[model samples]
Target: MSPLNWGVDSAAIADEELLSCVKNNYGMPDFWGRYLSTVPGASEGLTTNEINFLKSNGIKIMPIYNNFRNTVGKQQGIVAARNAIYRAKRLGIKDGTVLFANIERFFEVDANWLIGWVETMFSSTYRPGYYHDPVQGNFNEAYCQAVAQSELVKNQSILWSAEPQTGVSSKTKIPRFRPQKPDCYATVWAWQYGRNSTECPIDTVLADQKLYNLMY
Candidate 1:
């Protein structure tokens, strides 16, 4: 198995001071997942200065897009991809980065949306990824169904599973890699093992080495 790296995803703005505290308290992470656009009641978007700070500190960046309230259909998915790509470019993100669509558990995700997302991203400079729970629920069902029907989604798109929540751990006591398996075969690249940490404004993630290639 590939070595796993420690990382964090936060809904709050990870400023230098906050990140410095995180480094001191939780150890320096291999990657930091930030949003391209803010999601109400969820996350704040990445700023240019924040991006610069992360890059200069040698921390890789995982870009997330969470502007949608509902995973409606094909046209909406295409629009979301375009919006994400535009934001990424505006932020000076280079080609070939993986832009993850943040599909929360509450969203009504569908196979058509997944197909549209994959196809649109495949046509763009950046690759496609989905941040969703794969253990069970409508999201998992839709994604599995979509993968079964579309080879493009099955082979190319990446999955970041938010499952088997173990809560926050100290830097010296990170949890073992035991995320829940997806219902179907997919490139499960990153696993969010902990969330809404009380000690910090971040969630813990274990990333497969393959995920590094997609980071900024």
Candidate 2:
């Protein structure tokens, strides 16, 4: 396996000044995950200027879609995927990049939703990805069943696991890349090891080098 690369994801908008500060204080991250849609008072989505700034600074982008609270049915999954695609195109995201659907720890995820999400994305220009805690509660059961049933999901989808909460670390003191693995057979592209850092409004991550090929 290639060496894991350090990165960060944030709900707050990382402006030029803030990004500069983050680089100055913390080590430069290989990538930055930003939201695809702007929720009114909750999180800020990426803007053209921010995207340019990040690209200029040599930081790759991981576009995330986090509008849904529950993964209910196939139709809901299709709607979510379509919404994500629309937002991604509007933001000038290139084709073939991975668009991740953020499935929170507390959210309910079902195999139907996962199958629908993967199938919809497989037919689109962009690839499909999911961010979820596989080991949390009974999520693994549903995730495994989805993969077992859909070869498209098992073979084409990329996963980012949010497990083994290892708290935040300093810029110079990044923890080793030891992410908790999912119980099912799947390609885990990245791991969110440290979350909600007090030093910054970001969660630290370590990604498989191969993930770079799917980034925007």
Candidate 3:
């Protein structure tokens, strides 16, 4: 694992200037978040040029499946996950890719619902992952509990938490990757230390490149 360093992850892909800013102002990002949804800005989605650029620049992509609607039940989870797979495939992302299911803070995570999404996606083209807050213990949360109690969450399913660092400098800075203890899952792959803050150009996280390579 590498030390916590500056990185950016956004639905808005960086232009040349932004990428320059990233390299000059911060540093080369370890990973990035690319939207695989039909959102307004992300509707155009990813391109071969972008993938080539990132790969050539040594940045790994973290594909996001953004279902703007609530996925609170088993049926909804299945539907949303399936749709995410469809969009990913349409974007030329192959099967076995690891996709982070975006669970917004407004959505209440239910045990059965989360499991449904993970299982459906896992059985299909993409490997399943969750981008959510893990309160209390990591695996103790409802989402983790659901996965822990079932066979849906396999060893490959990655967990990315959105827990911001505390007592950091007021000045813009990249927090270190210090995962909380007793996570529901055995390991946490990434931690979002900055969320649309001045700390960086976009939301950012600290992750282990080796773990991230499993999906890519």
Candidate 4:
């Protein structure tokens, strides 16, 4: 497993907060997609200074959101995914470094579109195979999970980083989705943090990452 991957998510980072993260040794992934930056500066972008700061801290993997034009469930999000790849290249971020595109909602993805997009994404400088925020009720469509799984493995990828759940609400209600532990999820999470500790703690979420990581 990589020594990096421990991570935390936030909308905008304060200089001090970022500094504190470095001080505490937590990797910084300022949640820059900010739901697609609709407000024109309402959400934060990784500033030049922050980029330098990240470099100083040896934090190289940064997961920013690409605009996923997902509204009516047709999954035009692929367009955003392509654009994000370009941005990642321009910014000198590794391919796998751009971890996710949290869609307007999960499960709204157009399967065919995603399949085609992944085909293209592999050739880029990015490294990870495929990952997305696995928000619950996201996989209710059933086939999406398996299709995604196949794609990730086909790419010989790492983990599929999905959010277990939100709001500290249902830790007890959910059951583990997959039977085995995924190795790349750990690699993915640990890399996101830049460590094991910062990864999303899914009784479900935790195990899923591990299960995926083992793929390659």
Candidate 4 Cα lDDT to native: 0.39
Estimate, for each residue in 19-124, the C-alpha lDDT of model 4 and write its tens digit.
4643344223322221213334434554556655655655433344545445232244345556667655555554344344443334455545454444445555
lDDT digits (tens) for residues 1-216 of candidate 2: 886778899988777766766677677888999999888765798898889988998999999999877697898899999999999999899999999999877788888898889899989999999998877755677788888899998898898888878876645677776666567788888989888877778888888888877798
How far out, in Å, is residue 74 in model 3? 1.1
User: Each candidate: what lDDT?
Assistant: 0.87, 0.85, 0.67, 0.39
**Candidates in descending lDDT order:** 1, 2, 3, 4
Model 4 spans with C-alpha error above 4 angstroms: 1-5, 21-42, 71-77, 95-98, 104-107, 128-135, 140-216
lDDT of 1 at 204: 85
What candidate 3 gets wrong by more than 4 Å, as runs, is 1-6, 41-44, 136-140, 154-156, 166-175, 181-183
List ranges where model 2 is wrong by over 4 Å: 170-172
The C-alpha TM-scores of every prediction are: 0.95, 0.94, 0.81, 0.55
- Model 1 Cα lDDT, one tens digit per residue, 186-216: 8888889888876678888888888876799
**Higher lDDT: candidate 2 or 3?**
2
Ranking of all predicted structures according to TM-score, beginning with the best and ending with the worst: 1, 2, 3, 4
The number of the candidate with the highest TM-score is 1
Error of 4 at 114 (Å): 2.2
Q: Per-prediction RMSD in angstroms?
A: 1.3, 1.5, 3.8, 8.0
